[model samples]
Target chain A: MSESNTIPKSLQEAIGTESKKLSNDIEKGAIRRFAEAIEDNNPLYVDENYAKSLGYRNVIAPPTFLRSVQTDPLPDHIKSPYSAVVDGGSVWEYFSPVCAGDIITTITTFENVFDRDGRLGNMIFLIKTTRYTNQLSELVATQTTTSITYEPKKEN
Target chain B: MNQNLYFEDIKEGMEIPTIKKNPTTQQLVKYAGASGDFYQIHYDMDYAKNNGLPGVILHGALKNAFLGQVITDWIGNSGKLKMLEVQYKGMDLPGTPVYAKGIVTDIIDENNINCDLWLETDKGDKTTVGKAIIQLPKK
Candidate 1:
């Protein structure tokens, strides 16, 4: 698709009306391995006894552990029909901890999209918002991520 | 914990200890389960290649979490992680060792000890350049 044809200028232009939901089973061992990957030995993520002492029901996932969860990409919207898409950047807000044995469901929706003219070239910003709820339906956290879409330079 | 590194203790040129993280496919799978992200690009190399990626790339959240861990571990439990922002510049492939390193670029004490952090990755080939701001313990 051509640059002018696909690029969006505002939140209404870039955000899709449809949203997708995803579910996952967060396990204790998985949480431990995640902690190990980052080399964080915090007992809250490992020792059950220590966690209980701290009033947690079970081992809690790292604050940013939501990264491990997969998200459904936004559906098509008006404007951009670009052939390619790549993650431009992301912003995160760490709200609460996720625990093992908790089933997490995340709903993702397009938050915003904008066009920017940079030194390298023109780029498209795609923002997605995600909400997490546990099996109990308690709100766990919310993350809004922005991905940049780069299109091929227009040809004469 | 050393609270001696007040806003005054840090300098723009000073460096924080770089953390070397060796992530395994098994760990990636675990991360995938917890994050609820089942994108085939993270697990299937063939699928990833078809989708224009070099290999199964590690989740962006995983990379960002590790960056936070690096700074939080250094600051300890007494400190509060105020804010962390990162731009996904490149890929962090599975089974690759990503070294998360940061340097203190700026320091300010606006009610809290705040320092600007810069994060980078080395996976044989370079991938992901990130910067973060963290509040550290005050003396």
Candidate 2:
């Protein structure tokens, strides 16, 4: 059974449902791993002393490090119908740096969904917006991520 | 290193320093672990090929980070990165060299500098395209 038909309705109904995900306390080890993964050797991301010298309280996460901190389950209604999911894009606004030991909470809400006919038959694009707040109740960052889901076109 | 890139020192059309990275298969595995996105296409070559990929591919978010580093490194200590928007346009394979490059596009309201950024593979394929805004300190 094709699942694409129901995607639009489900996504439309999910437009304003905000789900609060598990809070993550930024940790030094996690920051180090993320920096190494991206091959970024910036001392501000891994060296506490270096970060302190730069006026930061502790080692900070790379600008996009928050991408790795989400451990929450997506709201069922907004989950992609197709198995093949790819990142479409993201827009991030950084209000403050993410420092180690800073507990951050994320509130995710579905922003939009649309369909377009293409070479691949049909493509469904889902946009999810998340707001991150630090333990001090300060807005740290806001990210809008788009995910594209589609069925692969089979060669004839 | 104190880049000390004050607002007055930069001009439109100036190019930001480029940062190059070589993403290995092992690095992809580490990225999978750290990002909790254990998608087989990023770590398992066989699975990737079956899925129509050339081989273990670098994560899109990882590529985004590379562009972020380019802006942060160029802005130095006093500048604050305010916004970044990226579109993942192409896939990048592991073990390949990716270069992050940007050029200042506009100087908005004296403090905000908007730059266009992108990641290009050694073969000249653009994998990611984006824009960033930074607020630099006044000298």
DockQ, all models: 0.40, 0.88
**lDDT per residue (tens digit) for residues A34-132 in model 1:** 787655777778988876775677888776777777666566453344455666656555445578888999888776667676643666666777888
Per-residue alpha-carbon lDDT of candidate 2 for residues B48-106, written as tens digits (9 for 90 to 100): 99988888888888888899999988988889899999999889887689999999999
Error of 2 at A61 (Å): 1.1
TM-score of each: 0.70, 0.93
> On a 0 to 1 TM-score scale, where does candidate 1 land against the true structure?
0.70
Docking class of 1: acceptable
Please identify model 1 stretches exceeding 4 Å from their true place.
A1-5, A8-30, A36-39, A52-58, A68-80, A95-109, A117-122, A131-142, A150-156, B1-13, B94-96, B110-126, B137-139
Using lDDT as the measure, the top candidate is: 2
Compared with the true structure, what per-residue lDDT tens digits does model 2 show for residues A24-60? 8899999999898888888898889989988887999
- The per-prediction i-RMS, to one decimal, reads 3.0, 0.8
Tell how far residue B117 is off in model 1, in angstroms.
4.3
Regions more than 4 Å wrong, model 2: A1-7
